[model samples]
Target: MIPVQRVPVSDRTQVLLTRWTGRVRDAGGTPKAAREQWIKAQTPRKHVRTALESMTRGAVRCMYCDDSRGTDIDHFQPLENAPLRAFEWSNHLLACSYCNSNAKRSQYPVNGDGVCLLVDPCAEDPADHLRLLLKSGLYDPVDKSARGEETIRVFGLNRPDLVKGRQDAFFRACSNMRDWHRLHQDADPLADRLAQALLDSPFIDVVHAMTRLKPVAEATVVGPATIPALAAWRTAHSLSFRVGQPRVRRSAASTDCIDGVADNALASDARSGQVRTGRRNNDEPVISMQNYGLTWTDITGTPRSSAVAYDESSAQDRKADLVNDGCTNVEIVAVRPGKLPEPRG
Candidate 1:
């Protein structure tokens, strides 16, 4: 599952949520009564529903399986368990019917110490807990913690159909990455279209999987160049918006043009940052896509963003149905990437 960026609800909506929570708090009702009230009050709040859907990753697919359309606003912390948290914005997640109604329901498993065993990708990157094997499409538990295993069981993450979908997504991502690399190397404009295709595709876990499992995907799916090319594209794509309109940043390290945008611009542009004119010499001048030193404020109002060797998306322009549906899951016994919290169990 992808990391969700929770957008602040409108003041009016926030007030509505707060009022609902207040009702449960003041009623001194059983969790059942709170849940009943919640079911009644939640349906009319289309605004809340809209906000939840907008924030979920990858074409609004179920934040759990990433296979089907997300139709339910799931309480990550079940209402039956935490009635007072019923209307909390942070407690909500987008989910598909099968995952919400059938697979998970209200079952929330926790360790004996009462820490949740469920992996909430909205709260943290699932990659840190579970590594999705691109080859067979099964998840590899990262630590001794039961959270990874429990999350998979709760969500039916390894169900045959879902496994097939993830497998399909992986190969599709690889082909698209290859296509993107080719287009990008030649400065082909269609590279942007392909990037969108991958981003918009179902099962975005596959895209993130490519980044997290860099060496494996490189040797098996595409080639050595996939991640670097995608890294450059993502950098350029994100930085494009930062400079007002889409223009490449021309650091001292950069020396070229974007497509054909001119090198010189207003002095204010220079003071602010580079304005276009740094395309690689292939069609533009070759520029390193590495090390933009990205930083951002995490949800807890803490800053943990760091400069890393690699980061995140890619795909083809649907030239000829480059990706066909397929199913798979396998375990790769490899060393975990980083240190995790000590497992409770």
Candidate 2:
């Protein structure tokens, strides 16, 4: 996971923006002054939203679980207890709401190393710090670090449903990759196939995780089954067999052009006694892929968006997928450079 930076804003402006934190409010909801306030607060929305959308570009996924959508503004720390920093630009994130409320709600506890256990969707690499129990469907701490344990305890990693969801995602993602291999083993368009496969699992974290296991290159591409269809395909190429893995990549710190601006914006709002961050930029709330698929390409052909909309199609799409296989219980986990597993060849 990459460390998310707060977009900059002047201290005064941020304070003026926080007054619109009510559970219900939009760019145009309320008294003339309130409406104007909302619009001003949203000035930074575009920058913040753009930064987040860029992170998930090209099939990138959630750092913690299999949420490929990477939607929602996450607080690196809990907003409830950390009130002073609640509107702090650095404290905010773009994450799935499920992750923000259900899996982790103010559950950050620290250890001696000063590393937080909560899986910060914007701060730590989840894979480097933790491992998953494939058979039992549980997440295990890769080290004795305080941050790892806190992540597990806070997110309910051991929760039967959550673990089950991870396991199910793992199985489906493996199946999808295997299917891709079967269909295109001899096809020369490897990159295209790979891209499509990645898109298939917009929120697939399991596939991302498995790519790190030893003997990854062959293992991930070759399925364990000896079924006729699989056997025939492998026999033609003399392929080796093994359990499939995810395609993990070496972690790198994301460029944070939005940080300084975010901090200044938050400070300004806070000083003005604003209850929340303002829309100084056009940044919008991060919605989930489960709710909105992986790419805007399906609708707009790319990541850049001129505006945000909550149309019927978007709503229906989210509901169906959630009912089918997505998790409604979302949580955000921060990932940092050096936290991801090695990618399989």
Give each model's clash number: 19, 73
* TM-score on alpha carbons, each prediction: 0.65, 0.48
Tens-digit lDDT string for candidate 1 (75-188): 888978988878776677889999999999999999999999998765566766787877788876787558988888898898999888888887777778778778756644
Distance from true location, Cα of 18 in model 1, Å: 0.9
Global lDDT scores for all candidate models: 0.58, 0.42
Model 1 segments more than 4 A misplaced = 42-44, 214-217, 220-345
TM-score, predicted candidate 1 vs. hidden true structure: 0.65
Q: How high is the lDDT of residue 304 in model 2?
A: 20
Error of 1 at 237 (Å): 7.0
Instruction: Report RMSD (Å) for each prediction in the order shown.
Output: 18.7, 15.6
Instruction: Report the lDDT tens digits of candidate 2 across residue range 48-149.
Output: 444445445334344344453556555566544443333345455665556656777556677678656576544335665667655456778887655567
